[model samples]
Target: MATVRVGEVEVGRVQVGGGVQIAYARVGHGPPLVLVHGAGLDGRMWQPQLAGLADEFTVVAWDEPGAGRSSDLPAGFGLVDFAHCLGAVIEALRLGPAHVSGLSWGGTVALELYRHRPELVRTLILADTYAGWKGSLPPEEVAARAEGAKRMLAVPREKFDPTLPGLFAGDPPAAFVPLLGTMAHDVRPETMGAQLLMMAEADQRDLLPAITVPTLLLWGEFDARSPLSVAHAFQDAIAHTELVVLPGAGHVSNLETPERFNRAVREFCRAHA
Candidate 1:
């Protein structure tokens, strides 16, 4: 139960199973809004959301087991493990029935959380995310992505670059580059390898049709990783889903177009709250 303040956000750690300390950043005061960031990134990636949406909602973003200040990713960790860890965070924070939101790989974990612990989620906000590589991408594409991840992990730690092209429509906003670079530089290869493998193997399509809560699918207009077609698939499968595409954004819509992304999330969560 340790906490420290960085500007307005209170960063803290909670012990989950296996004695792993999951770090999280929380701010504001309103309906609980939990953010799950993509692989290779941590809760700090949601700084824009924590700051922008704070006035409207209580925003909490977590560093999953392998990322940020959290403990290492234990061997044999799987998607279900990620979901259960998330469930523990929500429960430990007394944020059950929260507006659960995730981006990219994080979104897949959110779906798994819903599958195992629906009582913890009030609404779903999936941004530029997939059902899973196995579920959303063609077989060949999945294999290629897995191989790419393996290659990335083989790079020397000093030379590893976590930035993926097409994250933004063009260049990422200049103001965000420093923070993005810092996070990229801090990425641990072992953690990344485990997380990417989980992403590669995950398949949550069967759970999509079962999602009963209201879902907001926010996508970047030119998302190369998980394009609009994947968003459409989610919209079709999730019964009560509404899709909102950020006109000029790409894969990382939340960061590439924070204003539009936050606006859509604020509106949707308020309605559901």
Candidate 2:
């Protein structure tokens, strides 16, 4: 089995549906909580949350197929396909009724998991993500995002720092830059394109009402990727859901504001899981 080490977390591979090797890691010990990352980034993005949450709950963060330490992209993989892959991990690890947490694209995957396999999810933490991404971006913004994604994927890994500022609304902590650099390098361009295409085609508005499990909608007040209004719409749609906006935060809330993110997650897990 191949492995990729990042600080304390070790990325290990596991076979999911379609015979794909999904990379994952588990730390600390208690009820299991799965942390999923957004586009371009990998499971390593959950560094802050995994370290903090591991103290009380067993956190298993993994790279989606083709991201980070995961095997190369699989054929015919879509959002629902990604959801099934997670389901395979839960079954393989015997971590049923797990608390599932996802950010941005990761959140979209978690929503599908809950919708299709509610039995696997005990609770959900959907952070800085939207149920419906369609019509959210204006024609200009869509064009810009598409161009930006293309540009991001085209650039050599060493020259990618220019886009870091956009991930965080304000000046980021010094520690984040090098870490992001590592993540940016680990991802392949084709995988980035595939994930972006998945986002472009995803529309989960109709699936919201179907999610009956306890859900927490975590968002950043200044989030550009998923606006506050979008988060509120999720709050209104999900049957049982709560909204928590991180003040002065953006897309990567857990990393941008670790203390607040950890507190909210820790408290919620203690209460619900």
* Candidate-wise lDDT, in order: 0.91, 0.81
The best candidate in terms of lDDT: 1
Question: What stretches of model 1 exceed 4 Å from their correct place?
Answer: none
Candidates' TM-scores?
Answer: 0.97, 0.90
Residue 166 deviation, candidate 1, in Å?
2.0
| Model 2, global lDDT | 0.81
Candidate 1 lDDT tens digits, 141-248:
899989988898898888787776677889888989999988987888898888787788888889999999999999999999998899999988999999999998
lDDT, candidate 2, 53-145, per-residue tens: 888888899888888878888777788888998988888877889989999889988988887899999999999886635634545755666
> TM-score: which candidate is best?
1
Cα shift from native, residue 221, model 2 (Å): 1.4
Clashing pairs in 2: none
The per-residue C-alpha lDDT of model 2 at residue 86 equals 90
Instruction: Give the distance in Å from residue 89's predicted Cα in candidate 2 to where it truly belongs.
Output: 0.7
Clashes within 3 Å, all models in order? 0, 0
